[model samples]
Target chain A: MISTKELSRRGFLNMGAAAGAGLVLSQTGLIRPAHAAAPLAPVKAEEALIAFGHTGPTSDEGWTWAHDQGMKAVEAAFPGIKTTYVESIPYSADATRIFRQFVSQGANMVFATSNYGDFLYDVAKRAPKVGFYECDGRNPLDNLGTYYVQHWYPTYVAGIAAGAMSPTGKLGYVASFPVPSVYSGTNAFLMGARTVNPNATLQCISINSWFDPQAATQAGTALLDNGCDVLFGIMDEAGYLQVAQDRGKKAVMWNTDLRRYGPDAYISSIVVNFNDFYVKQVGRRLEGSWTPTYELLPMGGGVDRDAWGATVPAEVAAKADAVRTKMMTEGYSPFVGEIKDAKGNIKVAKGQTMTEQELYHWNWSIEGVSGLDG
Target chain B: MSTWRLQRLPAASPLVSLSARLISVVLALVTAGIILAATGKNPLDLGAQVISSTFGSSFGMADLALLFTPLLYTGLAVAVGLRIGVWNIGAEGQFNLGAFAAAGVALFLPGPPALILPLMAVMGMAAGALWILIPTLARAYADVSELITTLLMNFVAALLVTYVATGPWLDPSGMALATTARLPVEVPAVWDIVHWGLPVGLILAVLLAVAFGFTRWGYEVRIGGSNPGNARYAGMPVRRHLITVMLVSGAIAGLGGMMEVAGTVHRLQGGISNNFGYIGIMVAVLARAAPLGVIFTALLMAVILNGGIILQPQGLTTQTVLAVTGLILFYAAIGDEFARYRLIRNAKPAGTR
Candidate 1:
């Protein structure tokens, strides 16, 4: 019954009034607020609780310690959110129990750092409400996320530095399991050394555990005895560095800074800073928009950076800087170009760049690895 | 030379026994409190948390029951071994072998449910006994210490399980890590919450206890164990008794492994026992090798283990629980020692003066 202009003005005023009422309700805590009103449905108000499971005690003061530090940083960045953790969870049914308990205790997100991925996935299925993130590169499900450092890239870069600095062409790599993650890092080191010194050879050994100082020491001793002048470890334990120091050989470390463990022998180490990725994901989860998918952050994902230990000589700093720059800026992937499996099968051809998904599902061993079944 | 008399030792009074137990429990609590204080925790609060977590809910109670089932078996095994003066540290090895055998039966034998279930359990028990045979023989013939042989056999058994899980027995669709195939759901359920094997394990433990307490063979074994020379003089076959005790102990441990595989995991994984055999030794010692006491001690340990997980979410470490358990064991031992020997002060001052 009203004119067109009057009718339009009245409708606009009514809409404005409704919005005002919503704003008041939201401010007074009477109604739940949306993340963004226009584009996506407003995300629900969620309290993100990130759970980190470690195979060893936090007092191990190396690999688990570094990861715990990063988790602590995430907790600090986000107030009103909690971070729950279970240390020394055995890689068996006990691990499954702990994961189930975490989810039951309102852990919205979980980071399983151990290689027991098979059990983790089953637990994840049982706990659909909780999101799962595995540090190992196993076949992930829709609700399970997998992420790992491009350890090979940094290992090769460090290897080049070790090669150029070494008086002898012999290098030693003390490995944990024969899994693809450790294999890739070992093969990359060999390739990096070969790039610098074409005649260089790498001696590799697997101790079948992620952290066993005694085993690492024995393996390191054997490698050193076998004409390896420089040492490196793809294991979480820093015992290799201690052995290298005792033998007076240059050493490369993984997972944590080995300056304290082997101050004299530590040259450079690859440190995994999972906290950076964890913080961003946790922020989203806190805003109630958590998604379950693989998050493969390249060298930029807070890893692939080297933390030069106190043992690294000042003269090698410039060379290490040059190598790191090349890796970070040039998009130098370890899987690029022709590569062979341990069985002498060609894995990657020249001019080939593996997609992130392929890297995530890598199931083959690299060239020069021995004593591995698969 | 005309007359001689032998005096018999009087029986320990009930009041003394009751006081001894009470004092032991108090001592254990005090020791636990000291350890907690050293670790910067409130002992009372920690104790309460453990109690509440263990018996809080139906799920918690089920977890306790599942934990207790294995402990109960291991406790019974150790108690029987102790009664024969044989330290069977090989219960762990026997249990693992039993689990492996059970897995074989469950996986390979395809038959009607009625036939497969009981058959698998028997096979598991037999496998456990066979595994302990080497240690038993070594102790009997080679004069090797059963303690060392049994303990060493655990490593071999664990590795064997590992090899099978990683290679021949591995699940085809399993991940790169070592593990077995998913078990079938038809494995019987004891309670709606706890697995069915738990009731079986408890029943076996009770039956063994009753047999040990009431039967003539039980009395013979007890008499032989207390004094081998006297038993031999009484015409009891000491060596035969020893072998029978070892076999029974190993068989009981094997049944625990069967329950773990057929009821819970359904696969033989490495380190499945998780030192249950070792804990059984402690339980046996705490119970003074009595069948009834073994039941109670096993339940206490299970409560601690199940509750330990619950306390983890509340920022308490497993070490805290371990410390408390050690304290309890220490107190129990002290109480036992006091029961055997009376403390007396010598009045030498007046004589010296």
Candidate 2:
């Protein structure tokens, strides 16, 4: 028979070895089930819920307002649900700590309202029982999914309003970054403009930022100097429209209603209500029907074509509204047949519409727009 | 002629200054309370909420510890520069370079964890010093302004981070908002918050205080910064000492970047540069460029920031920290002024006196 001391030593060595292996595995994201959260029962909607939004609730304009409203809507939809959120949450190391805190607090579904796919993926893998939904991220973990509104189609409607109101054939489109989202938006705007004004051309430039008011205004000035009489762009605010207001040019806004900021220049905007999506997400989780979905909801699904600015005349607004309704009723695809890239290369061939997958990785801009400054 | 003027005090009384600072802290809290009331919150309840969220729980303490790890290093970095009469506004850029270099080494070199981690640390510090080389020379000999160059380099550093994080070093499997892959080696954690990074930062701060207190290098650096002509006339290598000051300052801040990447996030990201260098400046300024004071200020700032996050659900967002910190810094500035200078009615004209 083995001595008690010897047996205990052997046992201690084995435990140490196992713990070391566990640490290695966890670091590589290969450790499964060893330290994961236990399988948790879905909490009822009546229970208090938690949601985390990156870039706090009231950061003027940007994705912040949209996500903040989503959390508010979640609580409003389910009267018994008490929703809470940490605002101005950065996309950094602090993410996982805060996420774990929420999970530890019995938060059934945590909403990462930013493009923090990697962070969510890591946390969701470790905390397997908790569900995560990130906005605009592309990580497709087992318990993690992402959602982004296809605001391009509504911007197309806004472009139609711009086309109708423009006296000069040139239009300005300011882009935040050269991501696929901007590609989709600028293309749709040009397509809508060409549909209304066949000779319309776009002068588009990306400032490589989302919230630089001075740079945005400078881009607007460059467009105006180059003869663009109708300005529209993607930015945290309607800063570009200030140029339009100053120079008697028609303009459109992105992300929010900003006629108050640019009263004289405002024409229309692509206002996406993320509240609808968040409610659906919460409801789905409650029903246990939630699955990993890299979803890209379209204009009719969540975005609205709010094209009622004084700069856009009554008849033009009516026409834009009619076109919007028709497109929604007929489920019109944003990328129609025979869509041509700048090189006249076929992007969307005849009798085919662009899929969400195709749009998400869009690289080339269409014809009738300025160079992407490559 | 009646005039109110500020007269420089002979010497600062540490005890009186401490009392003044305490009074200023209380005043800041009261002002914060007024702001809270204006926003429709009960000041006492909110105060209770903040304390309970940050200090009441073990996990919250761990989070505070994690935040303190970076803050302490950054604060020391700024304080080191301030002691040498060099105002470094480029700790943020240096921090980015450190993270990039650490991640680079981790990505390219696959050695034993023990060897690789230390190599990453050394490489990180070297990279940070490299980042400051141009700005340091420009400030030291070229008669260029260090403040402008250091601040501008931060933008360049941001661009570099974006390029590296999104292009060559990007994790192949990652999404659009890309980041580098996680380091394979795991650094030991302190209560599961982060690694021994907190202790390392504290040790660095303590060592800095000692070095400044007892070392000849510290004495040389002080004279070189304040009276460069005197330092040169005394045959001291003022330029060399200035380089050391900048290098040490950059290295400390850079170490912070390495700690976050290797221990906390385990990745190189553009978001890593979140004005930590700027916050470090605040810490150094609030602490009057004293290393021990930096430790206290950094820990205090960390509590407010980390605590602010947990309280966001109760309407105390990160902006609450910004507001409270701004108020505290403002009051502390006034308090320090009063400690160093006395306001007196100007004496009658020379003829009359």
Candidate 3:
């Protein structure tokens, strides 16, 4: 039984010896050589290269996973075009530094996949030659593009299902940071729940982090203690679903189709298909018509209801499918007809659909929501 | 002619310090090689790629300079603390506070002429120095370890910056994101300088190195650090010196933060630092707490970090690069220990008959 400190020192010495051996082996040509006999054939010089920056690692099993799948698809589709990426560049000056380096390396197109909009904007301005895309709020410039999924509709639909399934009309919503996107989805979900069960009220809490499982679980437990039978979140992570499973409460997911993330607890999810837009944008860039404008990849963009919606039980899945069909085929607008703001002002009239302009200017929460300090 | 007798020197001159340094470099590379092999990468190619990406172009040079600028100050900060026998692990917090103060000054005060910029820089230094005062005083008076206090302060400083950017300091027109309003154009980089702060940071580090090498204060601090009891017995104000050293360290780190904000970011953002303070410890350690050596170590670190980003697109994982860096640091630490302590062979046992 060697002491831990002595063992650690021994380990360090062994490591040093091993490293020395490895260096000697390499220098003596005992290891395999780096270069092959022949060089790789040159790629077409005119073909555009798209470089994407991801905040999460490719092996994260979540957001970056889906984005990588889409990137792989694009790569397969376009043979001559080059696609490169830097993963897990933290959304800070490091991200900016990486973006600038990419531009300097002659990246014709660059995509920064994070919500640090101002940082993205600054980098975009500095590297005007490189086409930039940000997967966050709108900050469209001459060389920069912003895009977001229309999550409000799917979230509202998922809320309706949660409201219908829950024996108790009490629902819980765990939100992140009270951002407009999160707030919009939460408010819409509550509105949909109210539509089904008029007496139902949602207990909401903001945890101020996007991916902290412990905090999310704590928020979920707090919500359950407040007597909410069903839980949902706009966080798009597995934390809430796991908490729901632990507590045997129903839950809906945000951003991702998260059946795999929480197979036992996830009843359904409001999935965001970022791939459809990402592939399209990559294609557009390859075609040499890259525009700098806000692109909203709504539910009906390219891939429709069948591609995005998912649920646990067969019946719930059917209902989700039906709702998706109605929205896609029957042209059902979720916000159509007689909507009120949180302050009781009528926001939309009967037979009225919100225009793109109205959606862009949407800042008010829906009716029957409380605890908005923003 | 008769008096010109020459003594035979060893084939490798032990007195020539460059040989020892060269051995250390080779050992570092070997350690990196083992790491690369363990991670299933070709060491030769990785080494070539790192070199090419760091020094292949003007862009690489610019990137390297940008990366090194703040690290120079941070390295100096850590070196100062190491010299005074106090481990100041909270330079990151001090740096952040300095940046925050600089941003506040730039955003609020309407610019005069050239003098105002230096004034804001002074304010940044003051903010940084004041930030460390609590830990410094606590360590001096209450015997509380500055290490824990300083490290904990980093979290507080980070949270405070987050609150400021999202609340009162938020840019109104900058939708939903947590960031301060951009500083006015008046605080742009001085005279279109290349890598705006790197030259200044390098000059400061060099000046400090020279001062430390030749000055009486430096000699006293060295003596105090090596033997605190003896230093106090010799009538040196050890406690006061500790406080002074910590304050100076914090001020240097704070100035680095200010330069970053004013020169690069031009606004206060949450992710201003990517663990530069922590990296500062490594730089100082690798440099053996020598100011001039700190500059070179900082430059090497910058090359690795900046080149790591470039290598990422070439099928290299950041984890692999980081693993190599860790290996390098491990070897460097061991090398330093070997350099400092002579490993004596075994002595005869007293009762060996």
Candidate 4:
């Protein structure tokens, strides 16, 4: 209908416009052209496959076990949905391959139970349609989200009980690493303990692992022998708790209620539950309303301190419970300012409350705390 | 009267070794099959899945190559030490130090990648040699057992890596734990996720094979391994050969670690070795310490490792797969023992008759 010269000019203009649009879109972080227009289409429950890559064995009654319970809850919530998991997934190129394998198997959603970082990013970039979730993860792509719990609140509550019960007012904490979680936990615990006993001091030992029972036991022994009457740790198993019981010292633990290992030594645990979170996420994924979200499940929702141990005195439990009730009822956050680092440097100014972001990324050792390096 | 007796041969034929390996692998598979069947799993279906998943796609082959590359270097390292009768069980420590050194250069050095990469390689090799220097000197000078000294260093190296990764080298961006920042330079990927490491490992294996099979140094090392006393009596520098062979052994393993960090992981992290150094010992033993034979043995080990990964979706854990690997190694060891013997028919002595 048109002359050849005119048609060529029109076509050239069209190509230039298209190239410009792509460049602009990519620059603004909208490179996923397919997803930019709409959310992923809903998939049938029977056809949906959810894959999980766990960083540790499910047998460890710790972090991985908590995630495994969430997986089971997803299965129960969506009767027709299929779920599969690979445990002890190492943080290496092997992680990339396993995630890719999940893609090849037509996974509708993939959840890395821990922060896999670039290992998982490599797979998520190529598979835009699949929903991805990473726990304790920092980065989030359009198709990927991150989730973790506000475990510090419960840990602080347990610390109050530890302070009231400790005769020497000295606390020993066995930590995994100098990551944000360890920092926040140690700081929160010491802060709560100082409220009860002004002279209380906490010492932490970093064993450089999330689940090394032998090392944890040795660290606990060293702490107790150093005159610490109460022990606390962020280990998966009841390593330090067993050590405490053997030495007749009180200890608080993480992940699950490991009182069976040392009922006499148990004070409380920062128990974490991911059931409702996983169920809701999977439900959204199925109905096609899924979108990446960075969620920090608050106190008493996905995380809480366990019931008082049989050996815990009523007065100690009452003191800790009063703080727990106030925080839950009035949205009270004990992470107020006037806080100081171990080197006597005032980090948080007086009357200034710390935000969720600051609490989540806490990295320095607080005043009256020692033995953490970053 | 005639009697049949078993006689041990001084050396095993290549054909016998090959057959023994085949028979042992088959026996191991059959044993694994029985165990799977007992556990209510369909072995035949699982086997089909393993084959199809491993060889059916380009990605699978690339994955196999990535796994194969590290084993090749470590296998060659152990085999080289075997030539001089030095048990360099400390290959794991050398590998860690090599990775650490390479990562150090990548992190601190500001030069372009082109110059830095080769420098990283040299630094890696030097670090690996240095890591084993104490054990090597102890063995060559004081007659201390390299086996015990080398093995103990592995724990120290592991602890050191963990400490540095969690402390000084921890990612400043707060995006990762127990690891350094992602390296700026990578061993350029050749296909899919597989990088230049595959070819590098292959070339090293061929070069080592040539050097060990055709060089006078290799012949003297072999003679020294066979009998240090005899070599010394014949005016051979047995101590010099021992020192050089052990150092070269550590260097090869160090190169492996360097390639692993720069090529595959692209970061310095704890537990990066993934037991590759230990598994290389099995590969060397299966290859009868032959440099050229190591290629086939490493590939075989890679296949088994990949097979374990492919079967993960079938409700199999890494521990179960490790057990299967142990079974294969056990059978292969028994086969090696059998390879040294032959059945012979002989007549009774005249006095007995």
lDDT of each: 0.70, 0.75, 0.70, 0.84
Task: Name the best candidate (by lDDT).
Answer: 4
Q: Tens digit of lDDT per residue, candidate 3, span A84-192? A: 8987776567776778767776787788776766567767887666678887644555677676666666666776777676778888888765455666676767766
Candidate 2 residue pairs in clash (backbone atoms < 3 Å)? A56-A88
DockQ of 4: 0.43
Docking class of 1: incorrect
DockQ per candidate, 2 decimals: 0.12, 0.35, 0.17, 0.43
Tell how far residue A228 is off in model 3, in angstroms: 4.3
**Window of ten residues with lowest summed lDDT in model 1 chain B:** B1-10
Worst 10 contiguous positions by lDDT, candidate 1 chain A: A23-32
Q: Give TM-scores of chain A for all candidates.
A: 0.81, 0.80, 0.77, 0.88
| lDDT by residue for model 2 (B188-265), tens | 787765588888898898899888888998888887877889999999998888888998898888888888788877
Q: Lowest summed-lDDT stretch of 10 residues in model 4 chain A?
A: A22-31
Q: Write the per-residue lDDT of candidate 4 for residues A81-101, one digit (tens) a residue.
A: 999899889877778778877
In model 3, what lDDT does residue B48 have?
A: 84
Candidate 3 residue lDDT tens string, B101-198:
88888888887737667877898888889889999999999989998999999888877776687557866543546677777733455333244577
Candidate 1 lDDT, B16-93, residue by residue in tens: 554676677678668767866787878788778667655675655766787788888888888888997889898888
Model 3: docking quality category: incorrect
lDDT of 4: 0.84
How close to the true structure is residue B62 of candidate 3, measured as C-alpha lDDT? 66
Worst 10 residues of 3 chain A by lDDT: A23-32
lDDT tens digits, residues B66-116, model 4?
889888888888988988888888888888888999999999898999999
Residue pairs with clashing backbones, model 3? none
Q: What is the fraction of true interface contacts found in candidate 1?
A: 0.19
